[model samples]
Target chain A: MSAPAQELPRPGGFPEIKYKRNIPKVGPSGLTLLVGITALCTFGLYRTGQGNLERRELEREKVWARIHLVPMLQAEADRDTYRREVADKAREAEIMKDVKGWKVGESVYNSDRYQPKTYAVVP
Target chain B: MSTYREPTLPTGKFVDPTPAPAESAHPEVGATSAPLKSAAYFIGAHCKEYNEDFMLCKNENADPAHCLKEGRKVTRCAMDLITKLRENCEKEWVAHYQCLEKNNQEYYACRKPERTLNECVFSKIKLEKVIPGASGTPIHLRTDSIYS
Candidate 1:
């Protein structure tokens, strides 16, 4: 009882009390990260769209080219056929030269019994 | 050993090839797929009349002998167009076709080089690449295409 015991002040404030404010829940670093992710996703979507458009254009071109190619290809095939026929006629003439009364390209049977058919003779 | 003889071969009937028609004597166009694709539209535009005539001849008769003259004309016209392109737009032509060769001969993938070649051909050769049946503005001329 030495002069009523002096009251000791608490060593610190109540342990449950917080000194700093958490007003803005997200920090500047977190906001930056969110923005970066959004931009990257948008860019990826744009690239995908661009790739699709290019693929469609390629398909269109292929179709157009194929349509236009028919006539040219037909003409090429015709030229080959004409050349082959000419060669065949020449070969037939050479082969039948010595045979008596053998017409190279005429029908072989009397009274149109057998019409002339062009056979694909191998050389 | 069994005497399994192959049939006796026929003799004295050799294939004596004759010259092709004079009109069809020109050498074939030597360009392969990529280069030909690069110049396809231009060739179409340039050879329209000859191509149409050849087709008409083919329609008249299925016999190829009937269309030999028209076919030769078509071949000549295509060769002429290729020659003109080579003479006038060599650099641009090479660049565009090389791009096409790299990108599977797809026209859309080589628009930049194609544009250069188109401009050159139009200026020097006075020939334009016209798609035959495109309804509206051709896709090639569109500047705002996202893929381009």
Candidate 2:
């Protein structure tokens, strides 16, 4: 009446298992879709960033928009107020450099002690 | 032309990046780079902490100089720090502005902290504290002190 319940495999189990194995285990590749989505998102971020940057720039211009037009005009009227306040020695130094024809954009980058230095970290 | 990359140095062949051989593999005890030892660096590093005590981030870099919005206690401290930065920036401008001629290299200059008040013991004393206006105290009272 029972060869044994455990031994009763009336279904086609062996072939089914082989068939499953024969089919690749990997899912459909989404490389193209992933690339497309990433590209679109990156472009959108860049576009949004452009507008945000513009807004920030405009805001910077508007801030202090009415802060002190009169005071600023008065300060400008004094013209050489900042220049005159400085000692004659300082003025001479500036003039001397100009007379010597030192170009502002010249290689004075090396002469400035405060010039930033490059750092190389040890491995 | 072969684009040469420095191959990983093996063992004894390790090349030190320093121009001159370092006196020691490690910087001497208590040694700090001069750039890392500036007051601006110190303040920038502790900005958030200091701002908590002093109203900072009151405005991002968008605000004009000297237009301090007076309200937050932390803002006062931040303004003090910003004032110092602007004053001493001429010395720092060359390095901070010059060295990295390309890209956002200038920002790297603003990233150091050397003048920290590590040893100072700070205590909060609330004076003329503005208690939130309750229904009973409809009018805001300005006491002689801002301390709460």
**Highest DockQ, which number?**
1
**Hey, what RMSD does candidate 1 come out at?**
8.2
For candidate 1, what is the TM-score? 0.63
The lowest-lDDT stretch of 10 consecutive residues in candidate 1 chain A is A111-120
User: What tens digits encode model 1's per-residue C-alpha lDDT throughout B89-123?
Assistant: 98999999999899877787798999999999999
Please write out the lDDT profile of model 1 over residues A32-115, one tens digit for every residue. 989999999999999888767655665676676665454566677676666766677677788777778866656455653423
Off by over 4 Å in 1: A1-57, A66-73, A96-120, B1-23, B135-137, B143-148
| Leading candidate by TM-score | 1
Which of the CAPRI classes, incorrect, acceptable, medium or high, describes model 2? incorrect
Reference contacts preserved by each model: 0.25, 0.00
Model 1 Cα interface RMS deviation (Å): 5.1
